[model samples]
Target: MENFDAIVIGSGQGGNPLAKKMAEKGWKIALVEQRQPGGTCINDGCTPTKTMIASARIAHLLSRSDTWGIRNQGYTVDLPAIIARKNEVVQQFRNGTVKNLEKAGVTVLMGTAVFSGVKTLTVTMHDGSIRELTATHIFINTGAAPFIPEIPGLRDVPYLTSTSLQEEVKVPPELIILGGGYIALEMGQLYRRLGSTVTIVEKSAQLMSKEDPDVAAVIKKILEAEDIEVYTATTTEKISGTQDHIEVQLQTAGKSHIITGTHLLVATGRNPQTAALQLSKTNVTLDEKGYVQVNDQLETSCPGIYAIGDVKPGPAFTHISYNDHLILYKNLFEEAELSTKTRQLPYCMFTDPQLGRIGLSETSARQAGYPVKVAHLSMDKVARAIETGETAGFMKAVVHEHTGQILGAAVIGTEGGEIMSVLQMAMLGGITATQLRDMIFAHPLYAESLNNLFMTLEK
Candidate 1:
């Protein structure tokens, strides 16, 4: 048996940094990881996926070389090479993370851990040995895994989840993606741009149900314009097939139909990876959906045990998880008062015309009983968008009419994510829409459009 100041299960964005910070503070640390060092974001979620998406984006641009006054007869996509590059990038990140943890004087253990008693764990080491460990404080940051929904024949047959799809070297000629969430939209655009016919089937009435209707509409239009088929409010009756040929039965409007594709991608969603931890032995309590329940300060039901990242009930973005680390570090080590409740949520979907959002949408602000004013402008009105000929989306901002404070904003166009960050900073500083409109911004940039976007508000 070994004892440490803390035992951090899962080397995720939160756990890894927290473990290193504790070690740097002269605390004994046991950093455990069953898989790659850097959690989903570095391994399968962000790094590898975005690398491939960048390649796909290149393919898309090259395919449209004519519009850019460039002459290109045709272009070919080497799927294996693209996937190799992605793998190389993932390896670099993972190696760096592992090295950093080792240098921090952390006892890095490769194992699956289960709670044997309060503050005690039985770790089944990767080399097939059993070890015991205990710590004063335990932190769970196991993160989440791709949720493969139960569709008849889906499990028995070979289908790809978001994780498995990352290692796929051969691009399917035709791909059918299940679920129209962020994963589906991203992979749909990715494969479609990579010269595959892609179709998205979503059970919800609309894609990205959390967003306002107009926001979703713009994304849908962009996908459809690229010839990517989207089927919303559609249920999958059953799925059957082999790798070369897969079929899915669908039900919509009391009618049934069949569609076949060369490959299947299940992008439904993700579930927290908590079942294996055997938390029953501890005082930690989980919610109905199996996420570790935590307070505003991110402390679990147990006094010294904490939960962060996707394993806890909250937004499953890497940035959120990293922020959780900051909150815990300051409060635990620095004796600073900090809470996760007040942090702003900002995320961007990596579509051609990226969708960057922060805080509430117009729909949400009004629904929450805030007397709101909205300002909206199309990308065509932006000089940079026009000069680049990538005018396919718009910008929108929501503000409290009485307080004049910017509430939320969403941008969907070229460099939309960067443009949205400008508004996000403004919101953070309590800047008002009128203030933004009146301020002079440099021309020939997507951010300059913010002035026009705010100016369109009711005067």
Candidate 2:
């Protein structure tokens, strides 16, 4: 039996930083990771996917090079090369994570951890050894995994997931994605650009169902413009096929439809990684959906134990996971009063015209009884978008009608995330719509659209 000041089960964004910081502060910390040390964001999620997306984006741009007045014969996408580069990037991140923990003197345990009792754990090591550990404090940041929905014959057929797809060396000639969320859209666009005929089947009425109907509609239009087929309000009844030749039976509006593709990707969603933890042995509570129940301070019902990042309920962005560590660390070590509440939620969907959002949506604001005036501008209105010839989205903000406060905003265009961050800073500083409307920014930049955007609310 080994005892430590803290035992972090999962070296995710939150857990790793906390473990390192705790160890540096002279607290004995043991960080257990079942797979790669860097967790999902580094090993599979953001790092690998975005690295491949960069390659895909270049392919897309070159395909439409004529519009940009660039003369080129043609170029072919090398799937193996793209996968190799992505693997290199992922490995780089993994190496850094391991180095950081080692330098901080954290005991990095390569094993799967399960609870034995309150503040106690039994780990099954990768080398087939058992290790018992108990800690004064325990943090669970196991993160999430790609969810595979249950459908008839799904298990019998070889299907790809968000993670497995990234490992594939060959691009599917025809790809069918069985979800319409951000992950599905990203992977769909990636494969489509890599020379695959991509089809997205969304059970909801629209893609990105959480976004406003108009937002989702515009996104669907963008994808369709790229020759990607989208099927909404469609139920996938069953799946049947072998690798490189997959078949799916779908039902839509009470009509049966069948589709076949070279590959099938199930990108429904991700559930918290709590199933492996024997929480039943402790007082920690979980929601009906299996997410760890934590307070604003990230404390579980079980004393001295906490859950952070995607393991707990709420938004599951990498930034959110990283910020969880800040909140927990400040509260525990620095005696700083902090919490998850009242923290602005910002997220970006990495489509070609990225969907960057923060705070409430116009739809959500109105539903919440906020009297809001909306500012809207099409991407064509922005000089930069016009010059780049990539004008395909909009910039929108919701402002308090009376106070002129920016309530929420969404940017869906080229470099949308960067543009949205400018607005986020404005919101953080409590800058009103009137002030932003007159602010002078460098001309012909996407951010200059903010002036024109906020100007709409006044008119």
Over the stretch 257-282, how does candidate 2's per-residue lDDT look in tens digits? 89999898999999888998989999
Looking at model 2, residue 274 earns an lDDT score of 92
Off by over 4 Å in 1: none
Cα deviation of 377 in candidate 2 (Å)? Answer: 0.2
Q: Which candidate comes out best when scored by lDDT?
A: 2
- Computed on alpha carbons, the lDDT of every model, listed in order, comes to 0.91, 0.92
In model 2, the clashing pairs are none
Worst 10 residues of 1 by lDDT: 163-172
Model 1 per-residue lDDT at 417: 85
Cα lDDT of candidate 2 equals 0.92
Give the root-mean-square deviation of each candidate in angstroms: 1.0, 0.9
